[model samples]
Target: MKKLSLLLPIAAIPVLVFADNKQMTTVTYLDRGNLQLVATEEPSSFARQITENTPNQDRRHTLENYINSLLKANAIYNHKEGKENPRLIYQIHANNEGTIIATRSEQGKYGVQIGNRSLPVYGINYDLQSDCSWQEQLCWVFYPSSNHQKERWLEISYAPHAIAELKEGVSLLIRNLQK
Candidate 1:
């Protein structure tokens, strides 16, 4: 019994880690009017764990709804209605750490804005050092300046691209809320 108890914990370690992986979900939202999109990329294993371990379907649904609501409330999904035609939006791909992998724009109006926008906008790119960095391994969000050929806004630690956009959009939306 004593030996069995010691082995049990060791055996449980992999299970615990696997359980943790299952709770991750990837979500993506697009705002055509604002030309913005937010996406969360969770490992497949993690997402499966979350779905399987959720107590009930209602709880799972609620969680998904909440995430969707957050995306829309933050203007990540083009809150404006009745617009005849909106531009394609940028995409926000996030990993488990909430770090955005990339911000890709479809070839269209959205692509043009991404290329032409003069103001500072949130973006993700790789950090290259003396050591070679693989594309998949490098991910970050920073403000890219238009005036300078090689200028970057202060780069902070990894954060979800959607959350970052939501933070900025929420303030703007609040001002318009009363109106």
Candidate 2:
């Protein structure tokens, strides 16, 4: 009976370790021949409240436009075949966590701030939940006439400094909207 009791606590060790560091996000990039489709999400309530007085569809569109502008302002670019300056569709879904999705082709030197330290993103794995893959379109489907392209995004969790930064951005956006 004593041996059984001791083993119970030992088995709980692994669960306890993983409970603190939950799998934050999985960025899926579907490559449809010429263009890439990257999808991720943000906190839905926060996104919806960004434009409080607007209609549901309009609010989502406005949020997507705002995020796309942020991407451009940060100099993040996505490429497409046969287009000099291709404008990719920024499909920002409302979900959980602040996630950044990137493929293997994206080897840009970006830095992340964790707490007081800023570290360069050198493809260093940090409990990545799943791998991203490119899939060839097998069937023709009805895509919206207005929106059909995909854009990349950024997400962060388990990092205090990064969360603080995101909060600051959200506060600034709200303040500006109030003005």
Candidate 3:
């Protein structure tokens, strides 16, 4: 009974955060080392198709390598903070059925219908839970948690599209890199 009490709340985290809402959007850790969206209800065939269209590990590695190359670049990174690493960390998910689903969004942030469902999105944007921004175009932004040790990524919705955002931001970083 004692151990059971301690284990209950930990197990209930996802349920408490997700079940309260009628819409169920689930993300799981894919075997390929990425996060994949799992439909809480019956997955739409379109969503399944979108999932099928996602890039394989080999291609994904190539993209990651390219992104890594850009990190040292001038305009794209924020080097003022003294921490030189600013890399693209993606949490890919599909926008199945085109319905706006709030996976873990709270009340204030954006990124509802704007998320990159066409492919894996860069990040998400919920209200105060915002770990991302449109203007800054930073995803996987580490927001410190209670312990100040662990952090959560802010989800931001970028304009045009996730891909365009990447290209534009990279260019902006390069163009502004000299500044």
Q: Arrange candidates, best TM-score first.
A: 2, 1, 3
Runs of candidate 2 exceeding 4 Å displacement:
1-50, 76-179
- Mind giving the per-residue lDDT tens digits that candidate 1 earns over 1-179? 35553432221111112234554343333344343323334443322344355555243343343333443332222225333332333333233332333333323533444432222123322221111113322122233334334433212212345444333332222222212
lDDT of 2: 0.31
1-179 per-residue lDDT for model 3 (tens digits): 35553432221123212554555655454444454455466333322232255455333333333333332232233345443433222332223232222123222234222233221222322111223455666543233234444353323333333333334332222222222
Q: What is the lDDT of candidate 1?
A: 0.32
User: How high is the CA lDDT of each candidate model?
Assistant: 0.32, 0.31, 0.33
Better model by lDDT, 2 or 3? 3
Flag the better candidate by TM-score, 2 or 3.
Answer: 2
Clashing pairs for predicted structure model 1, backbone only: 21-46, 22-46, 22-49, 22-50, 23-50, 31-78
Best by lDDT: 3
Q: Which 10 consecutive residues of model 2 have the lowest summed lDDT?
A: 136-145
Q: Indicate the residue-level lDDT of 39 in model 3.
A: 48
Q: What RMSD does each model have against the real structure?
A: 21.0, 20.4, 20.6
Angstrom error at residue 2, model 3: 91
